[model samples]
Every structure is written in C-alpha cells, then in structure tokens.
Target chain A: MLLAIAQPLAWFLGFDSLMEFIAFVIAAAVAYQALKGYRLSKERTLLYLHFSFVLIGAGLLVDGLSSIVVLLSQFHRGFVVLYALGYTINFIAQLIAYGLLVFAYLQQTRNISAQFAATAVVSALFFERNAFAELILIFLLVYITAHTAMNYSVSKATNSMLVFGAFASLTIAHFFFLMFILVPIFFPLAHIAQLLGFLLLLGMLLRVNQPS
Target chain B: MIPGEPGSSTKPVSKYRSQFRIYVDVMQVIQREKNQAKPTRILYGANLSHDRLIKYLEELKSLGVIQESGTEDKVYSLTQKGIEFMNNFKKVESFASAFGFRI
Candidate 1:
C-alpha cells in the first residue's frame, strides 16, 4: 500500500502527529459547521459534508494516535503493527470520505447514472488504494477542487473562494504525498499542505460564523 | 425545488421558495423594519400572494414567533422567540451559502 512513506515519516513522529492532531480539529470544525447547517435546513448535501469530514477527522485521529503509541513504545515489535493498522484505517476512511464528497457534488446535478458511476469508481478505488492510496486521494481531491472552483467562478464569493482554496490545497497535499514515494523530503511538505488545506477551511468557517 | 434540499433535484429554482424559506423572508422583512412591519411591506418583500401572506402570518402567530399589532393599520413584528430563531437561521443560511448551497 502507500504505507511505504510511513516508515520514513516515523523519524518525525512528533511533528507529524502534532500536525495531524491540528488537522483533525480543523476537520471536526468543518464537520460541525456542516452539521449545524444540515440541522437547520435539512440539506442532504450538508449531511454528506458532515459525515465526510467526520470520517476524515476520525482517520486523522486514529493515525496520529497510532504514531504516538509507536513513538512511546520505542518502536516495539507488537506496537509496530498498530502503525500499519492505523495507516490502513486512515486510507480506507479517506477513500470513503472523498467518495462521499464526489457523491454530494453529483447529487447537485441529480444524475442517477453519475451517482452509480461514482459508486463503482469508489469501489474500484478500494483496490487501487491498496496499491497507491495517495494517488487515489489526489484523484478524488482534484475532482472536489474542480467542483469548488466552479462554485467560486459562479458565486464569486470570498467564502466560495476559500472553499476552493481549501480543496486545492488538499489536492496539492496529495500530490506531495504521491511524490513522497520517490523523495522522502516530500513527506513533511505533504503534511504542511494538508494542514494548510484544513486551515483554509477553518478560515472559511470563522468568516461564515462572524457577525454580519 | 433547490439542490441539497431533501427530495430536491435541481439548484436555486430561484422562482421557487419553500414554505420555510418564505417564513424566514417574512420575518426578515419585519426585522428589517426594526421589528415592526406593515402588511403591504411584507407582501412586497416576501413576494407572496396577499392570501398567502395572511395565511403565513397567522401560522407564524400561532407558532408564537411573530406578533401582530397596530390593529387599525395592521403591523407585524417578531416575538423574542422568533428573533432568537431568526438569529440561528441566519447562521444556518450563512453556513449553507458559504458553500454556495441555498437553504
């Protein structure tokens, strides 16, 4: 799987875990806002957004916690498997999360065929992720970013721009992650980009909640 | 029907306003008038049939979110509970709109 990059990032567990924890918080915040919106409006898209972020936040937490455990155990043999399990779970979570996002976007167009195609693609992605999870994430993020970009182009609102930036950052982060397979240095850069993506989402949430 | 809404297939349908949305629009008009609005102002602002406006107004009154006053000329205002609900609804609207989804 994409777990090959995890071995090198092990050396920087402290920083990596911290970045992930912060990203987790940001993801939860995004999920919370989506939930709040859903409750008020009963919007299915918002509900999808809520669940997707919840999955993302859960994945980050699990992965980060596993890393912390491995670090604390001084890389004991038994604790090491936890790292693999964490990576596997995180990979699967991201797979489903991004799938839901694509589903939400397709829902807007009300295309049943597209929805079925998405489900099939997501199923296909499961096997593909086992080979290169990062690439799959990159692929999904690219589609999401494209949708958000279209949203910004049409709405021309700063909030829409922020959403677009957030997804774009995530797409870049996944690209960096895919590159990490070739160069180890790309690992930290990937985390930085991922965190930037979440931070941009945080910025949007803050602006959205601000008194008008 | 608008996208994202339960059972809705398309976005905006700017011409279509949900009953709930109409309710919010009516309250907003009252709030915009400093918590006291005339029926004509509400009819124009919410773009509702006079019959629909009166029906919705009665509905709001029964729901305890809005109150009626100025019996001679007829005026409407939001109750404290209604004001709080509107405030929360505004947050929801803002959040949904941020993602370019209209609620």
Candidate 2:
C-alpha cells in the first residue's frame, strides 16, 4: 500500500525514478541488517537468505533505473535489455532465498527427503517460465499450508491455541500472496498480503524474544 | 610464621579457587550475550538472583568484563572478554543449528 501510494506520488512530483532508486537502496540496507543479525547469531542459513534479498534489491534498483531511462529516451532497446536482465537477476535471487528457507526448515526438522522434495518444487518454479512460476506458487501455497497445519496440530497438543492461531494466520497470509502470482490481476493484493505476513511474523518473533 | 598465618600460601588457594568459579560462571553468562546487552539485561538473561548477580557484577567489574558507565545512574556493558565470549556462543549456536536446533 505504501509503495503503491508512493510510486504515483513520486511520478507526479517528477521524482519517481529517484524515489525508486531510494526504495531499492533502503531494501538493500534492510537486507544488510538482517544479514548482520544472522551473523551475530551465527545463523548461516539465514545469512544466505539475506544475501538473496540483497541481490533482489540490487536487481530492483537496476530495473527501476532502466525503466526511468527508457521513459526519458522514449523506449530505447538497450533499456529494454537492461530491464530483462534485471528481471532475470531478481528471479534468481528469489529462487535462492526460497531454497535457503526450505533448507533451513528441513535441517531443523531432520527431514532430508522432505527437504529435497521441497527444493525440487522450488527449483522448477524458479527455472520454468510460462506457467512454471504459477505452478511453483501453488507448490509454495500447499507447502506453507501443510506446515501451518502441522504447527497447529502441535499447538493443539500443547494447548497453546492462541500461539498456534497467530502462527497459522502468518503462514496462511504468506501463502496467500504466493497464490496471487498465479493470477496477475491480484498482484497488488499479493503485496498487501506479504506486508501483513511480515507484520505477523514480526509479532511472533517479538513474542518469542520477550523476557519470560 | 604459623602454618595458618597470613604468610601461608594455603589461604590464597581457597580464595583463588572461589574466584576461578566466579570467573567461569561470569564467562558463561557473558557468552550468552551474542548481541549487546546492558548489565541488568545480562543479569536477567542468565537468571541470576539478586545476591548472585551482584557478586558477579562486582567480579566482572574487577576483571573488566563490564565497566560502570555513569556516576549517578550507572549502566554496565561488556568489555573485550564479554564480546569474545559472545562470539564463542555464536559458534556453539551455529553447531546446534546444524543438528536441527534453531538457537
């Protein structure tokens, strides 16, 4: 929602390109913070995920600059090539991020085979163009769903319904965004869903870190 | 001098052993502070009681694991040893993660 509002406002003020560049820089900075946190905690897997975020942020920055250049120059072929390259870079970064997340999850659970299956699905979604991205999105949706279900089951057993509900909602919100990629019409909705998911995850982390 | 007098070396042995235990315990608590932490925060994190925590604080002050910040409203933070200890904890945390434990 913020991005949507800011993008047009920046354009109206003739600062759209500059604002986009700033946003990319901010995103990269955030990724850097996450990476530093991981290092402080010695979390290698999370470090990889943060590194992916940095790559993706760089790609977005490049794409935004290229778009601005194209607009100013009346759609130059070079700008188009640059945009495509940026897209490819961003896609690869996202793939690595997802891979590291799944790998971390599997390592936590001691489930090697399950991790492999998840990795394969993620790889297909990343490498496959056309409907493959959509397919991968569906796989992510199911995966998050199943993960939430299992967490909920444990929560029920442990009689921590409230905690379970919070986690389940977060997982659902995350996958909901992934589902949106299947239907491009809902792309904006996907972004909103992601924001909500992040907020919820943040809440959960705070809860975990609370002095008890 | 008498065997149990001030000149005897045995008197310092018991004091040194106790000091050594205090040093080890303080190091363990300091190692847990992977991120920056105030003395009170470290006190709570290690779950030390009031007397025990005070003792540790005093010992750490002498050894320089922590230093007092202000005169009126004093705050304490880690010194070099504390930082190194925390880094060691990070290494242990990474090892645990490899075994499917999210530290």
Candidate 3:
C-alpha cells in the first residue's frame, strides 16, 4: 500500500488521490494474477502472494477513497480526522502486506512457522499511530528490497530487475514519507515515488505476458 | 523437494527439477508437440532419463491429464483437463516469473 502521504499535501489536492487510485488498480491486477495462480496450482507461495497484494490493493482503495471524500467535503474539521484514519489503516495494511512477503521469502529458504510471522504482523498493530509508523514500514521495505535485489543478482533477469526496482522505489517512497514531516514538499514526492514503484511492477507484468 | 525451492531439505547445488516441475515439464513437452507427443520426443524435450520418463508417464496417466494410444508404438496426448491446465499454467508461470518466483 506504500502508506502514501496520507495527510493533505494542500498543493496537489485531488491529483494524489488519482495516483493512488491508479496504484490500487495495479495492485489489484497483481493480486488477481496471484489468485489465479493459486487457484490453478494451489501453490502456498502464490497464496501468500495473493493475500499480500490484496491487502495492498485494499489499503490503497481505502486511502484513496478517504482522500477523495475529504476533498469533496471541503476539509471540514470532522473530515480532517479521516485523513488520520486513512493513514492508520493504510499503515496497518502495509505492515501485514510486507510482512506476508517477508514470510514467503523466509519460508522459501527456511522452515519458519507461520505462527511466528503472524505474531510479528499482529505486533505491528500495537505501534503508535503516528509518523513512527512510517519507520516500521521502511524497515519492512528494506528487507523486501534487499531480498528482491539479491534475487536480481542471482537470476539476472530483466523481470527480476524490474521487481527489484519496484521495491527499491517503494523504499525510497517511504523514506520520503518520513522526511515529509520535516518538509511538506516531500509529501507529493513520496506519492510519485510510490506510484512509480507500482508502475514498474505493472511494466514487468506486461512484459511477462507479452506472448513470448 | 528441489533445492532452492520452498522448504527443501537440500541446499542449492543446481536447478534440480522437483516432481511437480517435472510433471509440468512433461506436460509442456506434450503440448509443444501439438498435444500428441511420442515418448522419445518428450524424453528429448524434457531431458528426462528413460526410466524416469516411464514412471512419470504412468503417474500422469493415473492423474488423468494424459492418455496413451497405439499399443505397439505408443503416442501421448493431453486430455481436456490437461490442455486446460497447461493454458492456466502458462499464465501462472508468466506471473510468477515476473516476480522472480518459480511455481
């Protein structure tokens, strides 16, 4: 879900929502592909991947809708809290989504129990609902980014490189999210980076399905 | 359990195909040969030894994805389910490969 800028950026009002909606579409498409794979092959890893992207898609949809609602409501005091609510939901969804990805990778190489990973995901729910949430997301993205980077190193496939670039972009996006607190300008930059990450994934998906 | 795949006991030495992967490989070889592949063709295409090929062929037959014909000079072809499976599998493979994963 990339935990977008969340708070109103003021300058780029409706445009950010549109970007997130586009990202949600990409995430949902990825999730749908994973679901098809799971239904056909019944692979546990594909199931994990399906759930991961579902959470991401759902989070983006919620956040985007909330932003649109707030904008339409003219930023009334009651609507301002909706932004915070949207952020918290997206943050939690990202924690679970990225946690599932990490668990899949861990299970691929090792035999870690699902219970252990579930515990970590649930524990993330206890984090303070503030900018500190971005830090936790950044930590998970670092692990996932490093995993994809290592995968690209070994596989040396263009698709793998694109996946790595996507996660790397997301990692940068979250960093920009963290930096946005100090400077509001970082907010739109974070959304742009986040959208770029999903777009790279979309590019890889298109290339993969190019009837080779 | 092939090495480098999920929860395998062995460490990564080389890309040893798992039984599931081998099943897909044989099926794909059948599909590649216009869905009416001979054993030698599957053997050459999937790079399997003769003994393993017979064993897998028997397994696939039992699973009802393939059937044998021509008792004297046997030929293999995919069943409707097998054809549908390959079609679905192609999409799945493409999707997983995009994420650097093998299914």
Candidate 4:
C-alpha cells in the first residue's frame, strides 16, 4: 500500500522486473532453507520465517509479472488495471508477510497474545495506497531491524550483520516509497534500495549455505 | 548427561529438547572431543541421563550418523554421514542464529 507510483517508469521497466525476479528467487530459497531447518529442528520460529519469506517471494513474483505485463502492453488503458491489480496483490502480500515477521519476533520475546491477532491485517480494498499502511510497514521493519541489530551486536557474526543490513535497507526502501508520492524520482530510488536489500539477504543465504 | 539449550547460548532453557536437538548435541560432543568420545563423555557432555544417552546413541547408530566401537569401553565416533549431517547442521544453526532464531 506504500506504492505511490500509479505507473511504473518506462526506462526502468526491464531492469526493475529483473531485479524483482532475482529477489523472488532469493526469497524463495530462504524460505526453502527455513522449511528445511524447521523440519530438522522443529523450531516454530523457523516456520514463521519460512511462511514470511514465502509470502514475500510470492508478492515479488506477482509484482514483477505485473510490471512485465504493463511494459508489454505499452500502458494500454485496459491493461492499466493489471498494474493496479498487481500492486494491490503485492501490497497485501507484503502487509501480511511483514506482519507475520513482526508476530514471529513478538513470539520470540514472548510478547505475542491473542489480542494482537485481530489487528494483524487491516482490511482494505486492493489498489489503495495510504500513509497509514506505509506507517505500519515502517513500524514493523523498524522492529525487525532493531531485533536483527541486537542479534548482530550480541553475536558479532557476519551473517547477522548481513541480515541486519538487509532489513535496514528494506526499511529505507519503504521510506523512499512513501516519499515517492511527492517526488517522482523516489520511485526508482525505492526500487534500487529494495533490490539492494534483497541482494544483501542473498548474501546472507549464500553464507548460511556455504560449505563448512 | 547434561543437555544445554539448543543451537546457541541465547536460547533460554526449555523444559525439553527435541530428539533432533539431543542428537546434534551428542554429535557436537563427539566433534568437540576430536571426533572420538566415550559413552561417559557423551552422557556428561550432552546432559542426558544414562538411559536416554544409551537410547539416543542407539538411534544415532541406526540412523548411520554415528558408530560405536571399542570392545572394552564402547567409544563412539561420527560416521561419514554423521560428519556431513553435522556440517549441514552447523550451517543451519548459524543461519537461524543470524536471525536471532534458535533451530
């Protein structure tokens, strides 16, 4: 819902989709790894992580496909709806994905309860972007980033540092997205920041799976 | 035997560790002892009772990750598969720990 660019930029069309596609692959890989860990260790937190990344990958795939569709359609009036549909789906997916991540953190700290369940998803029609939604996402990312930061500080491990950087980058990307409403250039900047975030996450994954 | 927490030090002591965790802990003890450990070392290192350690050792042996030897003392060492499993487990543990989640 933080997406403010009703129409994606023409110049960055292919590149944006490519970046998102790559990010999608990385997200899916992370999810798969989390699932493997969950199966091996039966960790509930890993399960939550698996689902969160799954949703993130799904959202990225949908958005990337929609962007490709828009680019191929040449912004046809009829096809413009696809853009909205894609963004809306991606928005909802991210909302739930981040919410699940936040819930996972809360559960880790034993702060989660039934009361937070109902407030998890704020129902809204698709294609509706608002400050409120953006604020929620930023809030969630901040908490997750803080948690990762603490993790890095305690462990002083490169992988933890990467994860912390990735989340911090993502938070910045969302902030840029929120600003994109006023500054057109912020759209591309947001995408670049987001790609960097995912790339950092990919780095962590590679490190995690690297041969011992 | 003594079973500490799982994966990393950050995790609080839960009432029980999963079977998988116990297996990893036992293997870790073997690894820490330079890949050859006695039954008593495993029992003490993994924080398991004598009965539980015996049960898990049997299970690990059946799973092909560990093997027992020594006619008189019953020393244990990791098999090839067991070594690979431990390697993989270390990776998974680091990954989970990076996210502040214990596996």
Best by DockQ: 1
Candidate 1 Cα deviation (angstroms), residue A130: 4.0
**Deviation in Å, model 3, residue A80 alpha carbon:** 1.1
lDDT of 4 by residue, A1-212 (tens): 21334445556667778988998998999999998877667677788899999999999999999888877887777777887788778877888888888877776676556356436654422325687778777888898999999999999999999999999999999999888777878888888999899899899989888765
Q: Residue A71 lDDT in model 3? A: 84
Q: Estimated TM-score per prediction?
A: 0.88, 0.47, 0.84, 0.89
What DockQ would you assign to candidate 2?
A: 0.04
lDDT rank order = 3, 4, 1, 2
| Model 1 agreement with the true structure over A161-190: per-residue lDDT tens digits | 998898998899888777776798888898
Per-residue error for B26 in candidate 4, Å, reads 0.7
Going through the candidates in order, what fraction of the true interface contacts does each contain? 0.49, 0.02, 0.41, 0.49
lDDT, candidate 4, residue A80?
Answer: 71
Off by over 4 Å in 1: A1-11, A113-118, A131-133, B1-5, B10-15
Which 10 residues in a row give candidate 4 chain B its minimum summed lDDT? B1-10
Real contacts retained, model 3: 0.41
User: Of the candidates shown, which would achieve the greatest TM-score relative to the real structure?
Assistant: 4
Interface RMSD after interface superposition, each candidate: 4.8, 17.6, 5.7, 5.2
Better structure of 3 and 4 per lDDT: 3
Q: List the candidate 3 regions with Cα displacement exceeding 4 Å.
A: A1-9, B1-19, B31-37, B40-59, B62-64, B79-84
Q: Model 2, range B1-103, lDDT digits (tens) per residue?
A: 0001111223433233333334444556555554344557666766667788788788767766666677666566677766664454444343323222233
TM-score of chain B of each: 0.87, 0.48, 0.87, 0.85
As for candidate 1, its clashing pairs are none
**Residue pair clashes in candidate 4:** B1-B43, B1-B47, B1-B48, B2-B46, B2-B47, B2-B48, B3-B47
